[model samples]
Target: MLDVQSGGILLPVFDSVRALAFVGDLSMGQPTDHSLRTGWIAARIAEAAGLDASIGDTVREVALLRWSGCTANAAGFADVFGDDVAVRLAMLEARPGWAEAREAPGDAAALMRPLAQTHCEVSGEIARILGLSTSTETALRNIFETWDGAGLPASIAREEVPVPVFVVALAGDLEIFNRVYGLERALELIEQRSGKRYPAFLADVAARNARDWSCAMDEASLADFDAALITSGMRRDARAELIADVIDLKLPWMTGFSRAVAMTALACCARLGLDEAAQACIYRAGLIHGVGRAAVPNAVWNRPCALPAGAWERVRLVPYWTARAGKQTGTLREAAELASYAYERQDGSGYFRGADARALSLEAQILAASVAWVALRSTRPWRAALPSDAALQTLRHEVASGRLSGDVVDALIAEAGRSVGRPQKSATQNSLLSVRETEVLRAISRGASNKEAARELAISPSTVRTHVESVFRKLECSTRAAATLKASAMGLL
Candidate 1:
């Protein structure tokens, strides 16, 4: 059996790409998960139609990555089209030629000229930064291109366009029509685009295979699908790493966020005189604190102003989801719980449960301070990145307000003192445990039954029991609660 928590390590990366896809789909004026479902459906359709497995894989990857560039220029998009998310969503339902006119007049040339130019440039840059292959980048860049040479860059068309691009574009549009209208309306829309916006052959294939596509990608449980995919030979290590990467991709400022947070928390624990083993636990917990943000919508995440009351409530659930997901893995349960308090205030005003300072775990306090310091230095929708001095001042104010721990704030400020002239980016320290030990520890943290932990980690129950005993002994604890408390106090949670 594979370690479930280990499997989750990939979620951070996958979720990031998925989040970008969601943002792009939503920003383009489609419903959330529209693009994902389309990509899933496209891949399934290609497989069902006997396209090569590799082609199906590429199609799936391309579909998810197609709109990745949208979030890279979210602020810019908002500037050009007020309420960026709304404008893009509206574009999805707009009549042909109406989108262009909304921007300009019968001067179609001038009207679409800038939007197309901006879309291509921004989209390409985003794809490149996310480390996509050149071919993938090109396909993404040409996602808006038509069968005629009338799209952006004004050169590529028909056979000149990448097959994956063609597949994704056609599949996405068809999925949208099917959801909003019906089977007949969707086929009609595809027919309308047969030789212009879409390739006739692909359109015909989609129309012919519409039933299979619909059945395969309908509203099914993503959790079950993800499990099946994993069991069907998805590399556990790769999947975990990918998940981590996606979580990191949520905010540009958080590119290596989990690692940095883990490292910083460990360093802070060390500075406070925690033993090496306890510090290791803190570091691991820090690496996975934000895993739940994957479940939240990008609109609320990238909103420039105060969120609507309902949206704000949804935003607050991100931490709760993170903890819930972590609990599923068994190794990061404590870390997940602490992460739930990341947005919490010492004044007892945080989301989910708002335990005040006394009830807050030490790990939670350190995480709260660390996240605040890091976020202040990172760019966000509501503000620009703050200079170190300003960020420190803000942290100090929070401390004074009883929202952060005085000790942690002081330790972090002291850490900042050593880097007076250096940039204040987030950083991660080395892992305290060997790879195998970390795996065992992750399972232990989840409160996994010894037998279950053994099964999940592919080790004997006795071996798991031995490791658990060693873990408790090394951390100088007699029970799980004792170990958890010690870990939290040491900032390992």
Candidate 2:
């Protein structure tokens, strides 16, 4: 039996982290290997500076994870800059005009503080969940801090910012600037910001040997990093659900969308009498199918009118990036490859590859149908979510048009119907809480405020408060955020 709320699939820690780094790349408007290259550069910088071996390892992790929180604050960026991807890319490249544009007409720091806080908290939480060292978590939380006390979310100066933060900042600047601008210009820019952005000594060290480092990166392969670059050992498999959660965060309204698709795909597989291995593959594919979604900016996705040719081309490449990321990931490669076909059609009209039914695997077909079903039932910025019957009718129309497999659509609709209003296992059976308290926990886990949960549950604010307190007490957590994290780990959410 598949638990829809549980994202408990096992994956290697590196595979999950690297896949997430791909998401970070898309969110930052960089290529898929941008984080990987950043990690390599940071490790090299730490080595050249004669940092401890342990610090070098942590530097690699911090560099790869520097942009981990980008998804958490993407909507906030889109709100401020209209095109989050473009604005972030400009900021990274230090394009001559961005400083003026970034600070124009308002107190940018005041507006950026909250967004930075959200990013740091979420990044720190992800590190903690991965069971990384406290130092790594600390570095991630202060990733945006500057040497001069001008950074947002606290304005902590000099020694307060973690060493890995400085190392990664310089490494990122080297990676981005060296690529965007040549070594001479990149070195000059780093020299100018030396005291303000990072320590002057580190910048000098980089300026002296940046040419050699860039050449080494060009010649080195990812396998070389595995043998040479030091990284923390992950003894056990991490949860794949975290990947889904972070991917959905790129579009806030789509929270839980990946898990829904995964669970529905699993249910459809079972209904279709697929074997357990096939079911797991389909479920994993469903969760990761949206990895490419990060490549497109939030602005393009939010547009109400029909997309122009260029925008439509970007939309079609979503699964292409997902597949590309999977090919780079060792453990989840198969699932990722299948995930890339989530948009294919039976009649050969789908995107990124346009493979017909003959070329599509059964698992791919099932996943494609599952994605369509869940997407139809979920609301988007341009339209309200279709009700269940309406969603079903839409799928039926697709099936009739020869674009979807009839059997797959029927199985999905059956699973969805059976799941509607189904009573979940009681909280008493899973944890020490009443049914109402479980409901409150679920509501808050989705980021609802007490008043909002109260309104949604049709109970008074005080009653909601009572249940919330009981939930926190029973969970032994002092804050809603802590409670949510604990509950998610325990599969209570």
Q: What are the lDDT figures for the candidates, one per model?
A: 0.61, 0.83
- Tens digit of per-residue lDDT, candidate 2, span 1-493: 5554445788877777888888998988997788888889888888899999888888988877788888877877887777778888888998767635543357777777777877787777778777778998898889889999888688998999988999999999999998988888899899999999899988988888899999999898877765554365544577888888778777766767888888888999989888888888888898899999888888888898899999999999999999998866777889999999999999999988999999998888999999998889886878888998999999999999999999999888888878889997767686777878888877765556789889989998899999998987887654554455556556666
> Per-candidate TM vs. native?
0.62, 0.89
Worst 10 residues of 2 by lDDT: 226-235
lDDT of 1 by residue, 1-493 (tens): 1122332233233444554454455446565556667776677556656667656656665677676545434433444444555655556654554344243235544544455544554444444544555666677667777887666655578788877667777788788888888888988988987888766777888888887668766746555334322211112123223233334543444454565566567667767776755665555556666665544455567678988999888678767766655433434455556667777878998777777988887777877788888778866668888998999999999889888889989987887675568773221223333455545665554445678778989999888778767767776544443343333323343
Evaluate residue 281 in candidate 1 and report its C-alpha lDDT on the 0 to 100 scale. 50
- Compared with the true structure, the alpha-carbon lDDT of candidate 1 equals 0.61
What's model 2's TM-score? Answer: 0.89
